[model samples]
Target: MPNYAESHRDLDSYISARVPVIGMRTIEQQRALRLVREVATHPRRSSMPFWIYTRATGLRDLRTNAPLQEDRSLTGAMEYAASQFTARPNATLVLVDPDDLEGDTPLTRHIAEVARLAGNNSGSIILLTDTPVWSGLQRLGMSLQLDLPDADEMYGVLAGFLTDHQGIIPIAWSEDDARRAAETLLGVTEAEAVNLMATVAAKGSVDKDDVPALAQSKDRIFSDLTGLVKVQLKDADYTVGGLSNLRDWLRRKNQLMQADLRHTEIRPPRGVLLVGVPGCGKSLSAKAIAAEWKLPLYRLDMGAIHGKYLGESEGRFREALETADRVAPCVLWIDEIEKGLAGRDDGTGVPQRIIGQFLFWLQESRSRAFVVATANDVRSLPPELLRKGRFDELFFVDLPDAQDRKEIIQLYYRRYVKAEPDPDQLARLVDLSEGFAGSDIEGALHDVGAEVYLGGGAEALRPSFVMDTFANTIPLSRNNPEQIEEIRAWGRERAVAAGRTAGATTQGAPGPARRIVFMED
Candidate 1:
């Protein structure tokens, strides 16, 4: 149940201002009813009489907790309440689980009419719902969404639980540990917070060791959501190479990313957009970030979220975002974002509406699910998405430079060949792999290792064979020269270089006279 004290002031202000029809959208029906009773009886609000109507209980006096048995049916209760409004002009009537009365049926019409009459007097009709599915009544009422507890409120909840169960349960938690636990449990409801803490206390102690368990609990809370895959990081030792600028930026945000440091004034990093050549570690960086931060990674598959049924796509998308919020201080990896947003301008208008929803979440979401969106084609992305505030920064990951290629070659050699190539061999391999992507270099190394197996001897693998293999493979830069040029042109002007050094690093760099046309294919 929600805390009545937390929301009573807002409810009182709404009634005092004479907002005739109020929609209290919350799952905590009992808590909302309690708040309505408290607000109605307060002296500041003129101590208006309040009535609560439910299908089971019918119409009842909120102050005395007495039922009007004669007015038990829905029609009789509403009609009786409407009659009382003429005599007790400033009264309030609340109805719970009113989802059925949201249509244009006679009952709904009567409810709307009752709302208008209640407004003429100083009375109001408050509708309470767990799932606010009624669009019709929403227009007639001012909907007030009671959100889950914020950090401070969650802290109070945790502290109160600890105090209540201290001697009885033999619980163990310091002030610091309690604060940290509250931060981890930010998105759950007040009831859920108490239940989760109670579960932890049932073990006879609540310590810092239980924080990971809390995160896993949050994961279970969101297990029903589709298109969001929880990435298991155990034994995953991958890292993105040669993006010094990106690496440094992430390192600087290391402290702020710690959710336990809620007392700090610095705002945590939202995330970055990685737009550049395919197979250039754009997607890899998203995974590597979670690994580097030791945070959970969730891949939001935008393609998988699109449903054929009407409004299904939007519902799934909203659920996915909500799940991300519930499991915060985590990384949200969206790979190949351009592919999802490519046909957004088409006829159905579904894609455009989805884009609008996505934009709203991106700008307004207060959750700590850092968004790391990777895009292969920038020109297809909406211009609004490319604006400055959409992401913390837009990084352009061009092909590995000469030095990056060298480091990558050495890395692959050590991984597959199990030996570092001699300096002369390393230099030759780097020079031969110019314009090769990280994937291309890694692929060539895999091929070189395969030859050793087929030759039936580890000694069959040589540095020359590795160099020859890479030299023969034509890179994406050469095969798609026109597209690569266009991508480079867009990145150079609008995005920060991911590599440490800037300027032309690839051969046959486009000149000022070269005309680069945007092409999807």
Candidate 2:
């Protein structure tokens, strides 16, 4: 039902061609063994007897549950296998968990001898293990790999699981919900998928409520990892004040992100690279993207990816990326990505190699882990990274202008102060906070609210308080004028502005300037 026709055909072909040895790495040992039996015992094929061996189980008949008790050890099993071909050609010996085999004494030589002898006869040896192949056995054998089950297979698994537990557990999923859940459960092993579904059913129901639980299960997959962190949103709808153009683009792509777009020819959207001033809501946009899209947000701390041991960084990085893929249809936020990739070209080339791996994966991975990478300093970023096709788009989030400032003022005031400033007051606040970033507006309003709370309670928090506090506070743009100017210059020619403006190219243009309005000082 899961359609192992391709794998079966491949195995049958190898056996028919007298390939003496076959090697495969897989977690689903039972499934692989069943496939081998199916191929070996076929009605049309010659009668090829199959035997199995493991350290724990020793040597046993593949068709019958009978065991060869005397020849149970690794050496004994190898000797028995080598002897069997003399009497019975086309005998297949399957070894399970060869990594558990003790010592190097004659096991390697015996295995090699078996390979040589098996070639003369039609006998074959199949080895299975989860460990990386470090032994020379690979040279003598054809290596194969079993892929994770596809959607149709997973749906069958889910449907069968639900049917099996219908009386024992409650399942409220519609046909569509079951299909969607099966789609999300793709990329994980059959065991993992089964366990996850069982987990939901254990709670007595598998419905819309189980969907978040399924996503949260993916969080557990990343919990032990060092580099990636799960970001928790206080409000699932954490909206950004500005970035009109970028926001609109995301709005359009939202539906595509929600569905299983794997089968489609159109490559799913890779994601955007937000490059701009430090306090211009680049990082915040990452959180907002997850909230707005209704996807889990994982922050990949590039700084934490490195390790002291050799190859550890790459291994951790690969695992992290794999985990992200496993949890598809999610947002991966790499904050200040340039910091991780900067200065990588110098030194030992570890960081450079990491960047190389990241770049390659970003372009090639079919996984829908929409990457939202934010960078403050464009000069630190490598030219290759910024080249076309690295990301879907590169957006420059500059300082909030007049209209954006007003939106930020109102949004934050309502959030922190729990009171909305009327239009007249909001306009005055925006004018006073010109050249401020969305973050600056929020911070200034928060500080004013604190002072008002201490001096005169909620009634004391008014437009004048915000104006006074903002006027005294120096925003990051003002404090680091040279840095902001350099970033703006870099973005002016290369990047698309996140906000809307009049004389804009299809790419983007800087938004309108801050309007000057005199408020009581």
Candidate 3:
């Protein structure tokens, strides 16, 4: 992926500059072909000889999209493209998803030879693919990694299609809501976005009610991501048990995420580090944020990515990160992150190398991937990972207080038991669940749900059943009190509180330990 700070150019610029071996990466092959065609048909380049090649289609004339019907092998395509540059000046060739382009093979060498021939003349040879080309070949010219439309561009697409259908049907989305809808569809191509618009208007109306459904609809076209597991969010996941501070912060940052910031210098929040007690909704909060924002949720299992072969882990990690970039404007959940990046230095130095790589990616990545990393052992994390600007914020999620515990009870009770607990029942259950983590409360409710499911149904479920389950359950906080307090003490001094305790007047955010400022002399 190109750096977010870099500006993209019109394809015509390459032809005007007479760039040879122009390596372009895009999944939308036809779209890219059309762009190349447009550049070729421009008045200045109108008289230039143009050719295109694909393994399936063989060689074709760019003018008519007509096949030349000769040697259909890659050798024939390069032979043809090479002859054009040598025979005439200012010619152009487009190779679309050709095989054997990545390494120093016969085809790669031929392309390099063709590139040199074209370079000597005022001609261009374009290598268009969704995959990377060989570095040696690419270095002969320039490269561009085409990305999907950002929010502003996507909004234009949505408005154009909907405008054409304005008088034909009901269209209820205003510009703001339409923009939000477009933000939800960020990972899709322009063609895919148009098709999705058709799906929305298929029923003869495009209403604001369909906005949330955009994320749901986008699930149909998610890219085949490797190593990163897609996490499906339930409706209940939209409402987490506690962490009011974290929730409020997310709500505020969401505006920036959905805004058309193409014209602005500020970027969206990179993400937050949630360090807190186990089962205090740290992991669940990541899901809740994605659900609330109506974005796709993906979990990067750091533990599963480790490989025994040399540099195998780094390669897999790179692939996964690339996949994340491909599907941006989404949530990346790294649960129990310390388990992977932090461990006893086994003298291999692999852990340090991986940590360095991860930190660098986190700092420099321009994709709008909101990373929600949760860690129970905050102390185990390397100090550099917690630097002031590494994450947007580091939130400390302490064990839920009585009020938070009550909300947790009610939320899970309503979700799992299929009914709301009455006020008195809620009060009794809240008292029973004191010192319980959100997961502990949820687990007890799950037990009730399972028992009710086995015995009969919701009719068989009772408040006593929930109370008894909570009573018998021993939360991790109680099972290991000393460790919990140690974590709490560390958080109290260093991190911001995710949930305010009883009688606390104001929630806190992490304050910088030091400050720096520069001014013109």
Candidate 4:
């Protein structure tokens, strides 16, 4: 990155010289004016340098001395400049155009013509375009670029914006927030910033709490550039019980935020991967992680991102990543990730390329957006994704054991009945749910409830309702026993079990046993 002082000085020097052609790559009108002034006041190499200013909309006559008329083209602008400097003979000609000259057909061609016109006049011409336009103008020979706002500039801009507001006072923004926002909005022009602030202020009293929303709104406003949508975690309640060890790990992560405030390079905690049987709360744990982190959750639906148009999928993924960075200190949940990015045998490399890009961003991103990716089959995932440093931990969610099943039953009973179910009835239900996952157990409860409602009322229903539900349902362990055992055996050596076992604690105490739960098929 060029130093701020160097960039500013370079631009200043470029503007001050009576060069035949000068190009400025920036979006701010004020900065462009500053550059023009610097060049106009510099020691003149010639007695007169004609100034030709061109814009899509003609310059306003602030003096109210004449009616306003649009120049519409660079050729017309040059004529106007000649008229303005007729008496000076060797006057400088400054051409100012709000539209990027490269994109404007006639204007670009006129640039060469204008240069010829100022050949012996000791005049200068300046072209100004927004950042987007500048990228296309790279081939147009040496030009000056104004540096984006740094941390200090952000502070000044934010402070000034706040001071000018007459509504509720804005709270002091943290350095981290300011730095992150500034970097994410780097190429944004001053006018864009002002517009963002105005939109934010219009909704509510601008404060610290409102910053996230403002940032989200800005991301949405630029949705074409940042394709991301807000996501909500619906299963936060699942992490409350039977996952003590995992919860403790999460708690420790939260503590790290306060450990050393002075350290500026603190890495945001990389997230975890939950892999195991279907409905074993892998997805639920992702929701819980977001809740624990106290951040907004965004579910990156790969299906939504995949497009029929060539290269569109990759573009969408990049946009999503950029948006995630823009709205930092958030969570990105990529559910069923293995299936989402699986490459086909066909020669199309789009999936591979898109996944590669995603992983690269995951490893190098400086944003605080935590990524929680869940998958059912590890064998299908690319090995590079599972390597150390990609995610902090990988957990295996096996079938919930007997003890976990008991807890699941109690939790659901209390939630649905507002009281404990009969202990004997609950015991029987747990016994029958041996190899079921949390989701299966919930389904069983739903079946029992449906039976009770059909039979007339709660009085007519008994433990038999649950027994019948169990009898009617088929356990997944029976059909996929080999797969289940393979997962468990593989997890024994590699992953932390997400279940309650013989060595597990029941009083919500954290232990070494992988937290697990059993469900009815």
Candidate 5:
């Protein structure tokens, strides 16, 4: 339904009329050039135009098939274009140097002079750069912005690519899928996409199923080392007990995902902040959700992100976000988020600035990265981060209650134990492990096995051996009652209790009831 070819035609018309300057922000450079070519050959246009193009990075000289010696200097290139094309046509193409003109540079003076020369010759100039440094040029009456390839244009480009190698379509491609793929290619060049498609097609047929994988691989190649990793969401029905309210919240999120498919325009949920006791399955939930959604999972290691250089940290952060966008509809796991932000107070303000940038990106980004940030200490985080809009929901993971503990014990025993254990024995073990988190219960089970091994055989050690380990291990709740109570009190009203009834009390008072919905059979 969307027509990209028509959009390209409209853009071409606007540029050919001596528009002075045009800004094109798109992934496909060839498509941009094609639009320019269309405008150049418009029937309504009387004469051909000579144009001068400027790039921050040196441009390859098409004439010599080599880098031009003069290409390094914008002033010289403009002067040469002005002299050479003075008598030729309606528009003169001059390529300007971005570095020579960027931030507080004398390039502004040269641009003005070049603009005046172009006006005298009845031609126009175009400037291209990675970053649009247009403020300087805008003041000199040189500000014409062009739209990037719309849905229709993208479809044409993709169709052309597919047709060139694979021939006619065996089955009609879904326009929605094609448009999404095009949008994912945003900020990527046409040459890059063509080359990537060529590589993919070389392996096998470039069909619909291959699109998702190809899209992910292309992003991995271009966006630097720290790209997004795809993770599949877990089966909700198989998830162990506790946060009843959290389950309800996930149902709403699923509903949103479905709604987005229908409308073709959906803003992704902001993210989630999971804070509570350590080893309480906070990190596990992240992986479970990924498996549940049938997406890829990538864990963000803060240690890997911190760079020694002045600007490297920011660069790394940007690259990470870009990678996530390129490999859309994936999860990014940030474990111990508080620890990552803990190093923020170095006094140099670099870390603070980075945090601010991350927050801004989280709020404004249109990427499909569903962030799942886990933290054990909430006090270490800044107050601004706790604000409502930063995360879709803040869920507290407390120590497992009796029911939850029983479920966890069953899950682990079913996974690791060779023989089926008695249900009564499992209930007794769960009762003994009261006040203990899931991790502690697992550790206790490990201790039981160790005792049996040390005694030379399973028959040598009685059930009392396991019970002794459970009794001796002081739970974190007993060792640090004040801290645990404080966290529970703080998260009582504001946070949803995970792995329990929606209306279950974490401390003493009743909260709002959460509606539980299973995402799997």
Candidate 6:
């Protein structure tokens, strides 16, 4: 499929060559009509006789809306088209949305017959449809697919649509606002765009604040699409205690991610990979990114992609990725991606093939989909996936340090204990949770909250009870010291630390620095 400009040129070339049948396939019927009119009214092709037919409009002059016939049925329209081809040379007939042309049926064969007649007279048959033409009819001429408007072309389409409502609606949009709205409304059709604007205008005023409504409207069209789960974001879900380094990086990238980069050679920032110890904030970071950036979040469920039949697994994975692309300017969270792309195959090679397909899409896709993939086990990832440039950066999420634990404790303390944490008590709690991950701190706080709930209210909450909750629980680092140490060692060596640099480096620093220099001139 070509862009609008390319499609126009190809349509013009095909019509000039007297391609007896031109199947213009598109979901946008109005846009297709406008394109046909533009081509028909061209100076070089201005003299050619052009007519259009719809069930409601019957047959009419395409350039002017003059009725050519009183017949209102498709049968009647095709009957009239057949006679016109033989009677008039260089006559073009546009059949708008004719049904039953998907296979070589009676109607398709009839269309093929009319196409042959048109060919003899240097005329053409234009089928304006969103369906596939029968092979018999398609053989008579060529077909071109008109994809949805790109951002550049969409600006014009949106501006034109909005111009019609100027006097009636109080539109508070400038050129920049319109461009922003147009970019957000990229995936929907021109008709849908107009309808959405109309929907917004129906609310009594059209202002800059209503621009986001356009995106909301566009999203409604694809609300029920398959292969993705729409994650409902909660403010609490993004409490995100630490990872200042990751947070700062994401904030900077968000600025570039949402900007207009079509004219510039610089590509939008792709995404990041967070791999580290379990129960750290890697998973929550996905939610935080979406909340921070104000974009929709979709969790790609790899567990759902596996199928009982051959090829079904690959098909599902592809569908999931395609769905993500369709809903652009969104965050795609792949939690524990190692589990999904591990290089293990049962007698069949479905898993291997899926990995290849995934990498190709991730590398080539220019869509505004920011992928946030997390993994607990860095060792399980395929080598190709970890190569440079796969993601914008690779971040390692270590366990919450003393500073991070203090913040996490204070955050959940406010939520659960209904009070600000005492700074001195917080210091003690932080020390107690030295090896605790963000999740471990959250879990401990959650227990404190639960205990307060069961024991009447926050008034009855004992500081010792909260202290005991932190003291009694054995964190993951304590349960499997070897495994946690191994993960921390790998992260320290290979990945960018997600927490602040000081918290990241001060942990387990090599003891006793030595000086080797003596008297080198």
Q: Could you give candidate 4's per-residue lDDT for residues 1-521 as a string of tens digits?
A: 34345666765565455455666666466766665555555555334343434454454332221323466565565666655444344455444544445564565655655554553454555666654333233333347766555445654666577668755745455655544445434445555666777776776666566555544544444434245556645553435446555667778876553233234666767677878777777777767766665566678888888888889989888988877765555677889998878884537788898878988887887656778788887778887887887887877777777877788778766655445778888888877776677887877777666666687766666656567676555556655666766666666667776554422212321123232333534
Error of 1 at 283 (Å): 0.5
> Mind giving the per-residue lDDT tens digits that candidate 1 earns over 397-493?
9888988888878777777666677898788778777778899888888787678768765566655576677767677877787898788788888
Q: Which residue window of length 10 is worst by lDDT in model 1?
A: 512-521
Off by over 4 Å in 3: 1-20, 54-59, 66-87, 111-124, 134-143, 150-153, 344-346, 415-429, 445-471, 502-521
Error of 2 at 334 (Å): 1.4
How would you order the candidates by TM-score, starting with the best? 6, 2, 3, 1, 4, 5
Residue 101 deviation, candidate 4, in Å?
4.7
All models: lDDT? Answer: 0.77, 0.76, 0.80, 0.62, 0.62, 0.83
lDDT of candidate 6 at residue 139, scale 0 to 100: 84
lDDT of 5 by residue, 281-366 (tens): 88887777666654456777677777888878777877777666555556679888887676566876667876887788788876
CA lDDT of 150 in candidate 4? 47
lDDT of 1 at 519: 29
Would you list the rank order by lDDT, best first? 6, 3, 1, 2, 4, 5
Candidate 2 residues 1-521, lDDT tens each? 22456667777788787787787666687778778878767876556678899788899988775997675788788888888877888788888877532334356567768888887888888877665553565677687776677777778888898889877766787766776777677677777888888777777666676764576575554456456788888772497897899899898877666565556787778889999878878988989988876678888978778888888888888888987887776889999988888776567778788888888998898777899999988888888888889898999887777777777787887777777787877776776776777778888888867776687766765556566676666676666666777888788888888987421221112343233333655
Tell me which of candidates 1 and 5 scores higher on TM-score: 1
Q: Which candidate ranks first by lDDT, i.e. highest?
A: 6
The list of candidate 2 runs beyond 4 A from truth reads 1-5, 70-72, 100-106, 162-179, 203-205, 208-213, 307-316, 344-352, 452-457, 460-463, 502-521
Q: Specify the highest-TM-score model's number.
A: 6
Q: How far is candidate 1 from the true structure (C-alpha RMSD, Å)?
A: 7.2
If both were scored by lDDT, which would come out higher, candidate 3 or candidate 6?
Answer: 6
Name the TM-score of candidate 3.
Answer: 0.82
Instruction: Score candidate 6 by lDDT.
Output: 0.83
Question: Per-residue CA lDDT of candidate 3, range 1-521, in tens?
Answer: 33211313546667678888788888877667766776677786667888888888889988887898678888888877777788899888888888877788877888888899999988888888898899889999888877777667788889899889989999998988887777777778889999989999999898877887787687678656777999988887888877888888999998787776656778767899999788888988988999888888999988768999898888888888877766777899999989888764768777888888888888887677899999999878999999987899999998787788888888888888778888997887777666677888989899988888897888766656666677677777667767877788888888888986522321111222222222222
TM-score of predicted structure 4: 0.73
Q: Decide which is better by TM-score, 2 or 5.
A: 2
